[model samples]
Target: MTAGNTGRKRPTISDVARRAGVTKGAVSRALNSGTGVSTGTRERIRLAAVELGWSPSYAARALNGKPLGTIGLVVRRSPEILDFDAFFPSFLSGIESVLSGEEHATVIRFVPDAQTEAATYERLFGDRFVDGFLVTDLRVDDERPAMLHRLGAPAVVVGAPEGSSDLPTITNDAEEAIRGLVRRFADAGHRRIAHVQGDRHMLHALQRRRHWEQAMGEFGLEPGPVEHGGYTIVGGAQATERILARSGDERPTAVFYGSDLMAIGGYSVLGEAGLAIPADVAVAGFDDIPLASFASPPMTTVRSKHRALGSAGARILLDMLKGQAPPLSTVLTGELCIRDSSGDPV
Candidate 1:
């Protein structure tokens, strides 16, 4: 008999089996892998579950050697920092698009420091709270990968670090992106191009900083000032303030911020100093966020698909869960978007 629709408990595997006229064991196999079941029968069972609004419980599924239908994201930052950073939301949306189709849920946790971050990962894995992890905001010499490996947990990292092995990584090459921006500044007759960098601990931040240095040297121009601003408005503002404090002929004529947040923050400082973009001091940034175009002079930036990274990272984890040996890594490339902030469109 089919379970009543008015019950407190959700429709179970039995309900789907009853509605599809299949055995409970068959229902389990169809939902999990559909290996032994015919295509038509699998479709029928899936449709029945949809009609009955039935979903397998993560806890119940875990007991039977199935994925727990959940993914974990442990961020080593406070909630305030997360709220201020636009990349997180956009990235998460991309990840969710794939997870939603797979009928999986994401569990995000915020921790303050490295110790706490490691502890949280250990606790989650030891308790079987997640099937796998989506690791982001990687740092220099990050221990999370090693820790996860020792625990035998599956994970996908969003950034690539030198000498990293075992875990799969998704990365975008910023070398050409930075080279293009520096050339833009040089073509506009800018001799001094300063950079407001993100946290030095992050691999991407270091990559951007190194590219800036190399591009400047290659162009035969003196490398301008480098200030650590991190990826926050306040951090960017302070870094810009320091750059602006220099005397005539000592300050930079153009500034390349590590992220769009830093670029927007620098914009506020320029406004306070009565400096106009591309006229007094040109500006450019990474991660062309939604607000980049809306800024006073429309900030120039690099368009790295944050959503694509999220989706790709999740797909790698899914492959691992299925016991497939996916490629060791995936590298994405970015494009430079010129705007009024960096002079005329190029």
Candidate 2:
């Protein structure tokens, strides 16, 4: 229900909490990422909200000269986009934390798919709804940055731009990432390394893939079997199986997966096949999720500064909403965490 279905006064946060069987404080805590409700309860609240067609946005408030701010999150994942649990939940928490501190509102929505994700950029251009937008999952030919620049709309994208332009974007530091990971792996004495990478279509994926490959090369190790698995555990699993199928002389001694779930999936597959981790094939992952530490063998990976990414994006969006001309780009560094996966591969 796109906005026009309401003739009466719009629902209040109180009304939503009552209907969802939660207290006003619980609702506020869920919305603001404060110390409170469980993840399940929060999902229930958001889902109930979507079903009720309640939106607390600037466009809604404009009806009575009231201001209900909005920060629209645009992602280009498929309806089946798996493991969003890693990136978005934390990033959103960070974003919500910053916005709620300023007493603003946020609206999170999904696009049809890759085809429609680009078109959804038009929503930000609309006269109603959000005062600004927050874009994510950027790709190589992503057109939203340039389009937003031309339109002079307020925005903060989570990925770097392909070319230099006046668009607020926050990106991960690729070169430093490479150097750090290389040092970590070399210190472990792992010579043969492979990478199970993320979607090649995304700019972030390309940067991460390049960094991993470069780090391996700098350490005088042959760039091992790297495959572009589309940022899911299933994708990572398939890539891991392919590498393992190689002959002993052809197989990599260790593997580095793009995300934590992928690494975990690879570990599961290996365990079923009776391959001892570290002893036979070392494994590592990125994201450093809680699950990563609890995996049977405990996967080692990089901790991408996703929360900071969200915060930076929110700050930029708020600035744009305030009509400030902020720099169109930002780059943050990630930390390389070492654990049992590539255990001093001696």
Candidate 3:
């Protein structure tokens, strides 16, 4: 029953086509450029190939100068962060939803730092290991866009628009969401509001900080103290402790964390300090991860379409590989989910 049995030959494209009830050319189009074949037929062909354990030969692809039918994702984060970070898992699931049906594989490379990250991208593209890339975690001075452009690599950025590069982007409306969250706090008569931000280097973190400041000004309220939580639970707890060290009037009436995990961290600190939720200090966070709703007092946070962002970014990259021009910029909107943590909806 296995391909490793004696006298058993390897499955071929012809075999895959026969199993899928499609022509050889249809199989080729579906697996290679994704053109000419309908979506349903393409999925059928891919499923047949899976059942038959048929895979294209990389050696043959290289010899023929054909695409490798693989997409690359280079993540410059620690493995520990990836394990607990809710955003990445959901995003990856969205990417898999599209790539699995199209018979394209994803090549994920985790690097420790920027130098190795750049080198990995170059090597993957130069060696023909990937047909395109999906870039994430945009930084302040991100060089991946320009580097990939120079390599003539097809890539789509899943972050904010980078003015330095002209790469296609699939971004969430995080700024508006953060501003709205701030307004909600202000509307609830919280004059002293504090912010717990993530890494300053990340564009999203910077944007959230800036939007919080701007929104506070718009409401004629001086922005409260800001602390760097590093987007971690422990970091959030430590940051909250520092904020609480201030005198009663000097302390913030409410706090907005950059991520749900951090807000959860702040919860422990708030409880230990004998403060009541939304009574002593209200709390809100971004990225409404599953745990957000299950918290002791359901968290009020921003619900970013993380999965949609991944799916859209992958689809755009696929279109680019197929010589199609997708929209240069796609922005998805997020909703502010108000819950008990931030008090009754006003």
Model 1 gets an lDDT of 0.89
TM-score of 1: 0.94
Single out the weakest 10-residue window by summed lDDT for candidate 1: 1-10
Per-residue lDDT of candidate 3, residues 1-346 (tens digit): 6676787688999999999999999999998877898999999998999999998887898779887778999999987777789689999999999988767889999999999999999999998889899999999988888889888999998888447457888888877777888888888889899999998889989888888899999989999999999989999999999999999689998999999989999999999999989888999999999999999889999998999988888889888888899798898998899899997545
Estimate the TM-score of every prediction: 0.94, 0.78, 0.91
Q: For model 2, how does the per-residue alpha-carbon lDDT over 298-322 read when each residue is reduced to its tens digit?
A: 7777888888888888988786665
Give candidate 1 misplaced runs (Cα > 4 Å): 1-9
User: Considering lDDT, which of the candidate structures 2 and 3 is the better prediction for this target?
Assistant: 3
> Which wins on TM-score, candidate 1 or candidate 3?
1
TM-score (C-alpha) between model 3 and the true structure: 0.91
Evaluated at residue 139, the lDDT of candidate 2 is: 79
1 against 2, candidate with superior lDDT: 1
- The alpha-carbon root-mean-square deviation between model 1 and the true structure, to one decimal in Å, is 2.7
